[model samples]
Target chain A: MIRICIFMMILLATYSCNDVLDVPSQSDEDIVLELWNHIDRNYCFFELKGINWDSIKTASLARLNVSTSESDLFEICGDMVLALEDGHAFLRNGQTNIVYDFKEGYDVHFDPIIVEKKYLNSSFQREGIYTYGMINDSIGYVYLYGFQNRELFENIKGYFKQRNPQKLIIDVRNNGGGDSALSLEIVEYLIDEETKVGYISVKNGEERDDFTEVANVVATLSSNNYPVKTNILINRGSYSASSYLAGMVKYIDNINVIGQITGGGGGGGQSFELPNGWVVRIPHHYFLDAKMNHIELGVEPDVEIENTELDIMNQRDLMLEMAIEY
Target chain B: MIKFDLDTYRLRFSLTPIKHGVTGLMLMISASVFSQSNKTMFFKAGFVQQSTFENRLTSNYRGGVGLNLELGFEKTSEKYVSRFSLDYSKANQGKSYISYSTIYKVDLKYENLKRIHTIKGLYIGGYIDVGTMINEKNGLWGSTNNPISFTQWASLGMVAQYSVKFKNDYLWNMSLSTPIVSYIIRPSYGSVWPDKFLEPQNFNLYERGIVTAGLKSGNVALFNNFSNTIIKTSMYFPFKNSQWHYGLEYSFNRIHTNEIKPLKQFANTISISFKRL
Candidate 1:
């Protein structure tokens, strides 16, 4: 019996020692299929956007042949991914870049030159990643164009604590989101109590609805005391974490969001690389408001005001003016 | 009392030599006379090297070097033996990721001391082990920002061991174990960032407890989704007939799984141990 056991152990050991280096051979079609399957399994917005992924795959496969160039394959893959209509989705190779088309026919509503000359009288104070000053020496105006830096919020908070302005305006027009944590940190300075902001869930399986249980996301008050009343300026360009911030601010007190509806991007982006060294990014997590409503469509402002071409031509930010009036 | 109890004294003296000779014969028949029933404690520390590949994160398998430490205790009797050990290891895979793991294992076995006709001091045993492994991997590439994959598994396996002792008090041991079942905790297809997952209300005991999500309902699998194989060998030499013994040990462990990602890991370690009987 002992000899039999020893012999079996040796046999098992010999079988296990076989190295399992099973790297899949990637042909052009194989790479396309890999990309499709990755997105099919991981992308968060498939069902929400009513995408027919199988049809898309079939169409894409029909475009690929033995003689298709890599550039052409990249384009076909890019076009197939763009069908998801998510701004966070993109495909990039060495020389080509494909991104969701966010530009619409709306005229540019924000011009810094005009705002600086007409609104702040050329006295806009520039801090780290933030430009701040008083509009009419009353309303504190802080313009944050991006959410990349966490320290910028601290500087803005310190500047506001000293001034003790009764009203403040946070302009996030054209602010493309960077890091959601930084956006949440900025939200911390705007509230004084535990605020149930929203819920977040991630794709748990390959099925479209295979999501984990919704996890409640909350914002706690910061150490610094900010202004009692706040106005957030947003436009169609506010996206991703910027849209997430807009959703959170609606739950806070004494804060009025005023502007055009934000350009919605409520999904968190995750990146995967294709076999040919190109990279593809897709949204893999969903962010919803406290009411369980998906925020993929841009969040509506408390007071929806559209800036006209006339307003820009006159060097007047109508939204900022509305925030000051509020 | 002056009338000596001659029968009792004569019987005691006569039985003493007979008892001594019987004990000598028994000792001669025993294969390993030095392996008396005793409890022992051991401490081991060593260098570890690991190679890992996860298809969800990257295509290339990466290698890392790190350290491992273990503490163990074993009890031996004529009928059975039992041992318990705790091991911790940490390794870094280039700039992409780092992994840390801890395992606590208990093994119970029945010893078979019957020797082959020509070979001496040979002992064979079959053991069943129950253990838990907690592993965490943190790095970039999986998500937008920093990503972390945390997994915990309750494991059970069977092992077969062969041990031999030489007349010079040197002992050699070899064992192989394969997992029978494991309850594994793997993140869903898309994992939330750690900062969000650690939120007060978002974090719950269920996420860290046995009732958490897994590959199947009730989260138990019999070598279907997750499998592990381990092999170890050691040699021990006593120091001048003292209770203390020093030994060198080498181990190889591999785990393969098909979950959110197809992940395969191989770890090799060599260590020196000190055991006290």
Candidate 2:
């Protein structure tokens, strides 16, 4: 009887719809200040990327006044997000979604028309999330759009056991990135030891540079030994976890990094809620190679190459041709 | 789908999520442990009107209507009574159309009250309650801005009740409860989660900051960072001259927490039940 009474009573109490809480509205200036102050205290790349955060805040706060509307505030906030320059930064207010990207005014260094016709025309096959085949009978090739799929590496392990090639070319162009552990998953299949690839840290204070002690990002060896010479193909489009991959494999003695420096996004995307119920995304975690060299600007390649439009017209992919020969 | 087995006293649920399926299986197994006792089982449903405000997300209070479901068992003796119950409720409420929040809570509790008065039916004792409440706002951004507020709390509280019996055999009861201490597990202010275990390169920043953060529980004073107060009124009388009692019950609770940011919620609920005598 007591338990039934308790349940019925609780059910009875739930039907009262009372408009009791009174919350005041925030002004446009307050919203701008909220965005600016949050990023100023928490954003991790002000010093590393040489951003003038104070000046950006001043410019944004200057745009708001007595007559500034919500749309105007949205634009102002969007501009500030763009000024952060990292692809992980974003702003959303239930209506508009905004993000910062770094794919302007630079050579893409890749062309689908050239690769499909020249390399994968007859070998148009996909296993799991991977597209792989032979560039020829002697060399193996696998091109990934991102590290969003870990099965790609798992499939690579199986592919190597079956048709073990003398060389393998890994392409990560325009791979915007995903979990960094997927990068280590690929490295584990290639390396022979528990090697430290990079360092990982998170911000712990309001200071721009305040962070936790860096933990060693290590990749251990797998049991099956497929001792193929590895070449990682990169470009300005390879970013974030892919850049992290390039940074790690470059330390391996047998691997050669071939192409332009990867488009850098070395931070993990983190978010917080604003007073107006909007979400603000920013880079909060930092990554560095084992030697304490910064990876935010990108991982330098051993063989820097770019695809020329003229070369594309001549049906020559010098990078792919180079991977086939190296 | 939910299937009940009366002979073995168990419930089986085929849920794709797998996690929920495991939890349901565990709940049934627990029910089977106490199946030998002579007890009255009750299932009840009612409506809930709630108003809540969380400064971590916003400053405004949002109100919404929702349905409540509760199931439990009770055993009564001349000296004392015990109750074990679980409840799940969900509601959609917000200030703006796009500012909506999907809030759901599954609460489990066990309490025992001992009769303190010899002449009158008055009880005084304690209860322990544990609940996890998750408030998700604006599903527009998938998994990112969801579960905007989360709190897992275990409370030790005191309960008091008084009853009056009329000559005609109808009984009226009133009770009040207040938490004496609470242990809370909540996310810190800055970061929530991307992927909890798979991310080797990420850690929550506030874990190393001023306040200590972990999965462990801490002993907090009554009303320090958390408080929940409940009041209830109920009536029981003869039902159609049979060996059953008809009852009407009303319950109210106010839950408040300011550990990281202020979140205050109030619920008023009512239901009717039949008790086997």
| Per-prediction fnat | 0.23, 0.10
**Residue A199, model 2, lDDT:** 73
Q: Which candidate number maximizes DockQ?
A: 2
The TM-score between candidate 2 and the true structure equals: 0.76
DockQ by candidate, in order: 0.10, 0.13
The Cα error of candidate 2 at residue B48, in Å, is 5.0
The Cα error of candidate 2 at residue A46, in Å, is: 2.4
* lDDT value, residue A256 of candidate 2: 84
**lDDT score for candidate 2 against the true structure:** 0.68
The number of the candidate with the highest lDDT is 2
Find the 10 residues in a row with the least total lDDT in model 1 chain B: B4-13
TM-score of B-chain for each predicted structure, in order: 0.66, 0.76
Candidate 1: tens digits of C-alpha lDDT, residues B1-277? 0111110000001124433543564344343323343876566778888876656554556567777776656776654456766565666654332222222122222222333344343444444444433222333242333243444466665566567777757888877776557665554467533223423365321223223212232256566566667888999988886867889999998777775566677889899887754
Candidate 2 C-alpha error for residue A206, in Å: 4.2
TM-score of each: 0.70, 0.76
